[model samples]
Target: MSDILLSAAATAACLPYPALADELAASLTDSAVTVPPRLVQPLPGGASLFVMPANDATVAMTKLITFTPANAGTGRPTIQGDVVVFDIATGTRRLVLDGPTVTAHRTAAVSLLAAQRLAPNTRGPLLVLGAGVQGRAHVEAFVAGLGVREVWICSRSPASAEALAAHVRTLGAQARVVDNAAAALPDCPLVVTATPASGVVLDARPREDAFIAAVGAFTPSMVELGPAMCRDLMACGTVVVDTRDAEHEAGDLLQAGVDITALPSLAEIVRESRPRPAGPVLFKSCGWGGWDLAAARLAMLRVCAEA
Candidate 1:
């Protein structure tokens, strides 16, 4: 069969968050998913290409992506890629979905799933770091899945941040760009860090009951939360991650000398029905490959429905 193509916009339009969440939750609990570590090939010019493949009972999918941080200066996306879906039963390529959109939706949806079970709401506005794809996507996902009345964006590029802020305003939220990310943290009940920074991004003392979703630092060499902040936040509430692998892959957790095995995975949280703590809770994601499988399967289903 010919491969079906799903663009980023179409993929986002057809994304099934609830179904994807349920699928991921089940896979985590049952260990039915196979998510191999991604193969990374970095170019000499500081660009990186990542190839991640995942499989399950229904489908096998692989995503090829590139990260070119310098592309932003040229008015290009820093992240670009596509996901190829294969029929596990027939061993045939079936569909191709836009990579960034799938990644953005799946990543944010995973965090949203955690937020639903953990810190459901906060008293203040939502603060997001970075103005790129993941940053804007997280904002939209949170506002869609939850009730976000206000949003504050912090970015290295004022133009990008303002652009994202304008988009958020169109989404019916009070959105604005803030100069100080650290300063904005204390007042925000929900904070998302989606930058590519190699060092700490959130270093402030947040609200007693705040929720943090760290989505940027996916490698051991990169960190989003400072050691002190990580320690303080972990001490306040349960720290949940997307997968067990994050314990080793997440620099924020590792640099903080956090015992990853002790922290609950999102699956464990869903399986055990862990009660939300009264204090703060942090969700650190290192980007699970299994989630790609779930997302691709969802896209394939949508393609079939349309056909």
Candidate 2:
């Protein structure tokens, strides 16, 4: 077997949002793929690294592997990443991709998938409570996948919010910048919290018919939504998570006094035949290794085809 290699620039040229979401969803729902246990290492400087191994019988003869290393230092608190793809059958290295862009796409795709399932009838101005990479990606994903009419972005820095909003408008989305989260909450039926805050940023009770996607704070020490969000989730629609194990380990739910018993896995939500509870729905994702592997594999395939 021969292996293919791809760089961050090459991968970006081939991986599109809609296609990535479709591929990831199929891999996630299919029973044939085998995703191995992820290896995680926390650095002394407060950074973290993760390695994921995966294979899908329908996709290729060789298994796909991906490595992601993220760092959020104390001073800068930057989240930088890198992805490497290898072909197991040929023992060849396929690609070295940029982790940040790939992560933004895949994470937003997951959020969009969750929103599609959980918030079927949602409309009006959507609220994004972060202006970082993830925040911009979320807007792109939502515009591509949902029926959002307008977007309101809130960040600590007004300039950052304005910049992100400008980008969103270029993508054919009606967008605006806001100074606070509360101002955006009242009119937003869908709220996404993507900040890197170590404490709560959105504390108000959600609207009766809203949906929330909280993707920040993957570690035990960080949080973007407070106890009120958890309590709201319990009382409202289903709480879907990428993996209950990851959430339990990460402390996003546990730290907020959220009962694990009340949480439902993403698979459960997708398979449910009956009507779900009324009110807002919450989908909290704590980055999973399987997602990285799946996305990397797809990106690598594109690199090979181009070569």
Best by lDDT: 1
**Count of backbone clashes, every candidate in sequence:** 0, 7
Clashes of 2: 7
Best by TM-score: 1
Estimate TM-scores for all models. Answer: 0.92, 0.86
Task: List runs of model 1 lying over 4 Å from the truth.
Answer: 1-3, 16-19, 120-124
Q: What's model 2's lDDT at 271? A: 49
TM-score of 2: 0.86
List CA RMSD, all candidates. 2.1, 3.7
Supply candidate 2's per-residue lDDT for 170.
Answer: 90
lDDT (Cα, tens digit) per residue for candidate 2, span 57-123 = 5332222223222333233326555665656677565566666667787888888877777774567
Shift in Å, residue 212, candidate 2? 0.5
Worst 10 residues of 2 by lDDT: 60-69
lDDT, candidate 1, 18-94, per-residue tens: 66666666666655578888888988798889899988887888899998867866878777989988888889888
